[model samples]
Target: MPSEEHTGKSQPPVRSQPFPLEFPGVHYFDEQEIEAVKRVLRARSPFRYYGVDLQGEAEAFEREFAAFVGAKHAVAVGSGTGALSVALAALGVGPGQEVIVPAYLWVSVVAAVVNQGAIPVLADIDDTFGLNPASVQARISSHTTGIILVHMSGAPADAPALAELARQHGLWLLEDCAQCAGGSIHGRKVGTFGDMGIFSFQMNKNMTAGEGGCVVTSDDRLAQRAEACHDLGYARDRNGRLIFDSPELCLWGKGTRLDELRAAILRVQLRKLPVVTAAMRRSKYRIRQALEAFPQVALRRIQDPDGDTGCFLITTYPDAETARRVNLALRAEGIVTYPQGISNVLMTDWGLHLYYNIPSLVHRTSIDRAGFPWNLTENRGLGGNYAKGACPAADSLFERSIVLAIPSCLTRSDEDDIIRAFEKVLREHLSS
Candidate 1:
């Protein structure tokens, strides 16, 4: 017989361990989008070179998206990078200017500033891995021309405070909506708060057009500026003829314009955004609740000053080492997990690759410097030189973080599989 102490005390057996399970290979598509693409292909009416069909479809998409985001105007572009570039150019950010950005945001946001010949002053993010207005305010100086606030991972970072900071400092605020399209803060849409808001319709985005983007703003002058900038800075007279009749002025602009086919596809997707967003919300909530039960995982809070969130989950592990281990283990189980990209603003966790990774994607003995000039050609007012350093919070969170995709088409089984996978790996790591 066991001692009284051992006999009286009892512990429950652990439930079956959950492991990350691979999701079924199912495709999610709306029939309307397919037919829309087919229609564009059949017409084949000179879709390129900015024709009437392209303009009309682009205009229609712009209107629909602007209305959806509660903005007065929207301008379509070839991609999210193009949208940010034109928006910054419209704001008159150019050489020698500086823009404050969160270090942990997507590299494209920082590149947008650098492309404008302006300097990118990296600011630290708060616990949510987003721009903290105080940190941004502290970074402002005489050369600081703009603030690019990103809603990283679809969580609405505090916009009102940042907007107020920008106003007080006389800084132009450009909202990077690439990750948080269709979201809102304090009942206002995501793209309607700042001087300019840029959205991505890249294939992976919630509102996809294969490869396209748009800029939203209430200011008509800014809208026209962006429109002309994206179209090679050309102006048309009342009859739509080039006003500068000087054939002698032989200057051309780059082609960053959205095509008609993608515009039509965007229109179809735009109509389904609300439905898709709703589904994503439901799945994210369930997965989050399940994941939160494990103390080892720190999920990003959706306290976006915008009240909505969708499709992906970003979470931080206890530290970079743990994050690395869990990510590897999850991958072995066929679960997709990885760190947030390199952050220039994250002084403590600065990873320069996030800015120039595409150009130098593979580690090679010879670096390609040919793309350097082109990479730094656009303007959104990031200029001037300053010391580089580390941001403790951004470094800790970004390096030790994991991002998971929450597809709108996920079924209950898929969601359960995700939850189980997270629980299993997290528990195993924690226990060991």
Candidate 2:
């Protein structure tokens, strides 16, 4: 646990929850979002860039989102995973090169590498539940072209260190901000820390439009490349028409354009992002503050407590068995850890989030029947292990830790109940 003055507060009374916690932005849905979508529908300009009504909501959203994250540009895409693919493509990360990604990241990260016809080398995460710079350094080789730094669980990774690491080795750094849209580090927003950053607006994210995403970057050339990659493999000319003059700019694209309906909805959600993150942060810190009395367990390490977006609270017990028993006790008291129907708190149940759990990755599934990426002459000896024990530290930590989703809609009473339940459970087990 990080050093701080222990609160030493006594346990409060536990009460039945008013409701279970849920994703942040969904709780604040109001007429603004509905009206935004209504405006788009009324305009009949569902397409972005060149709509019939030309509402320009998608372009406006990209501008606002770029300014919001302190980046020069933003490209609205079809999904978070598509943004990853676009970023990898923009950086020219394919065939014969490997991209180092955190083992504790979404499957899309690895899938993007494979889809780009590149190898993905897994790097262990540190206590921050993010990429360990030292581990990344050790994995770097001649074939390494870039590193994908994922900021997980609404907390910023050690970006400054990782950015410097990438610089020292001359590798492109792409920050995955899908889980932490509005998070920052030392007051600098997360997405601007690396060469480029990606965000998601899926149903379970901090903000939601059902499903949407964007990529942010400060580089002009890369931004153009990303725009082309998200479109039809053709860079737009100055007059805003597709141009196929240069072979460098005429690469194959994914056709991942952002529709105006989702863009209109996201414009409203983007404005409310700070509010969503702030509420969860307050609730999270208060719970962590109360739990500081328990010396027997530790909270997951954070790069900056002030910068944490605070969607989840992770506590590590001495062992996996103790963590499991404590969680069962909490649930018996009507205090759930994760939201209903979601059981990704433990790594064993964390489906595709962990590399080893992904069947395609573990089995080295081929994209084409020809088995190009893995069987290619350039990639023959480059396959890194993707078995269960490949990332021992991350696996062990997840097994011994309990994650509690902190909803932005939590009331003071809700926060008190959660703290009391943690107090009750820990007192019974750790007071020994």
Candidate 3:
């Protein structure tokens, strides 16, 4: 706690109880979800493709999710990481190629690229906390094959500009919508903006089934490739048998199939997603409006405010130290910034999500001692600097920005408690 002498103002009133920090989708579970899971279990058909009494929950979820996101097709995967690898393999991002990714992203993003035998080139993030188009352009080379545009937090990235860039360079655009599953830009859902897009229903997402995700695409051939890559390295006939006629078009499977039990829960969660996002958005907007009087703190730039999932609120201070002080004050006030992964909330903690802190990527460690991916025969001369100052803009941004998650369920008092803390803390630390 900062002493009154250090702060130049008396400490504000603190909450008597700890804030209710919770997982979003979990809050909305009820009898509907319980009955859905029971139906799957009772049928004894836990698998989606085949069983004694196949419930078709997985197939139904995929079809509904694809339609909701405005995509022609969707393939359910075991997890978000599974979806990422499937999308990369579908795009042929392997051996000697590079994929441009934002420095502020999930660690699994790089893992997906490396698993495909491709390299991940870190790019800076702008005020949007999304990929910087200029940085991506500067890094593109003959070895570059695609751009993985991540909708960081709850908001959509600048997909139109990135899509145009991809078209001009003839590179595939893969949208990482794990953070922004129901997000959109001007009413066009996020997952449909790229040639291939993926969403996570992990426990922490806007909607969840504990561990599940899906890949969506409008391209017929790309959809086929993703299906084959996620299943058995071959296409299945209508009667559920593998067909070997299209050997040239076949992709090696990673066996990332989604099961019937998870699919049933996800189906219920999907129906409740709009409501989940709406509640969070309402609370977040109200909080931001109340905090606007403090000019020292700026809100994150959302391309479409209404389209955001509204789970995370990013507030930026002028410098690193001030950001640190304000965050400490908030915690002292009994406010939980982000509970799922505390490291991601303030961007203060390292060795978690930041690009430079990734030991394997920064040190260029590969599966083999000879540096298989980095030192592969086709990867000669392809390199990147993953040192501390590689992405200068993003490095500073992380230090200055503090993210807070808006719970799926919040009462009026809950909202007021947040605003009260911001009002008290910002006035003391941010007042000129």
Candidate 4:
């Protein structure tokens, strides 16, 4: 059997007969990245703690990223989850409040809400694999205080609709742009449309610095709150200079500031993001055009065709059974696809952890052992059941969907192999 390394790095040359195409690895670090890291080390004083240097790589990164996203301020944090938690906390989402989140997203989204002592009401997603505005409206309750819209798989969600919904309900809109750094909607960036937007620079994200995140916002108060929350409630003046002597601390803040080392590395990655995202977009377009012959397969809906970051290519089959069969066939052909069902022990027992399945959240016995947030006196009668069919759209979507990770570094031949594999599989399946 070919090892994972061989499959991802060096597969046999493309041939008439189908051969596995090497998956594009993470962005390669060259002299620029090396120099950035070296410069940080040479400085030896990358700390952002109180009373330390203020102008550093982290600050520079915040400025560059904020400018890139067209936001007035950006607060650098330790990770994407940290950014979410800080943003929620800064926005005043607290105990007894409900924050609507998409059911089909990384578990961290749920965890961030949990960490903030707020309830995460799971909402279903439409074909875009993002929070369905209708589902979001349905999930909104008297207790609902905010909505976290995830741009899943780097495809921009219906931001205009979601934004209007937030306005109508007076709910805070937090855009989770973890998978969509360069993604835009109608020429506007994804992270700039909400009250506050958060981005991830984790290893797998479109723009990465090993592991980091930032919160961007045009709202001055929200930005200051996020910054203070990220740095242990350190008060900041109007100019965002840290104020050490403020008597009032708004909330219990966590120390989740981004360090200088990673920030330095991110500076280099940020410069390369546009080029990488463009390549991924071109790869997606080529694959989509190639698959047009197969009417049985449909690409995931894009709310805005021109706004996709092209980090992932998701398709749906005619039905669940056919989707499962094609998934298996594609794997046999060494083309990776989203796994079907609970295939292993981890997935079987704890698969819900991947997205913190709503049912698990409602009946969280172990984590809520103290009965604090889930069953607290303040939250009594607030907790509800997340039954198996709670989110029908999201449930059905995952079953019939096959997600292919589109690497930014895909070569022309690699893209060709991916297209040919899909065509070959669909031809055989349709013919049979």
Scored by lDDT, the top model is 3
Best first by lDDT, ranked: 3, 2, 4, 1
Better of 1 and 4 by lDDT: 4
Tens digits of lDDT, candidate 2, 292-390: 889888888887887899888888898888888777666555565334535225545667878888899999999788996888888877858998788
Off by over 4 Å in 2: 1-18, 237-240, 337-340
Better of 1 and 3 by TM-score: 3
- What is the C-alpha lDDT profile of model 4 across 1-432, one tens digit per residue? 223343243434223333222122145568898898878777665764422434478888999999999999999999998998889888987788888988777778877877767777878888888889998998898899999999987799888899999999998899999888988998999988889999998877887777889999999888777888998687766454667775554556778889888888888888888887888889888999888788888788886767888877878877777777666555555564223312111111234433435445656543656865676665655534455566787767677777776767777887777777677668767643
How displaced is residue 213 in candidate 4, in Å? 0.4
TM-score of each: 0.79, 0.94, 0.95, 0.88
Give Cα distance to truth, residue 35, candidate 2, Å: 0.9
Off by over 4 Å in 1: 1-28, 46-55, 237-240, 244-254, 304-306, 337-389
Q: Which ten residues in a row have the lowest lDDT in candidate 3?
A: 336-345
Off by over 4 Å in 3: 1-12, 337-344
What TM-score should be assigned to candidate 1? 0.79
Model 3 agreement with the true structure over 259-335: per-residue lDDT tens digits: 99999999999999999999989998999899788887888888888998888888999999999988877776667
Location of the lowest summed lDDT over 10 successive residues in candidate 2? 1-10
Q: Report the CA-based lDDT of candidate 2 relative to the real structure.
A: 0.85
Worst 10-residue lDDT window, candidate 4: 341-350
Candidate 2, RMSD to the unseen true structure? 5.0
User: If both were scored by TM-score, which would come out higher, candidate 1 or candidate 2?
Assistant: 2
The local lDDT score (0 to 100) that residue 420 gets in candidate 3 is 91
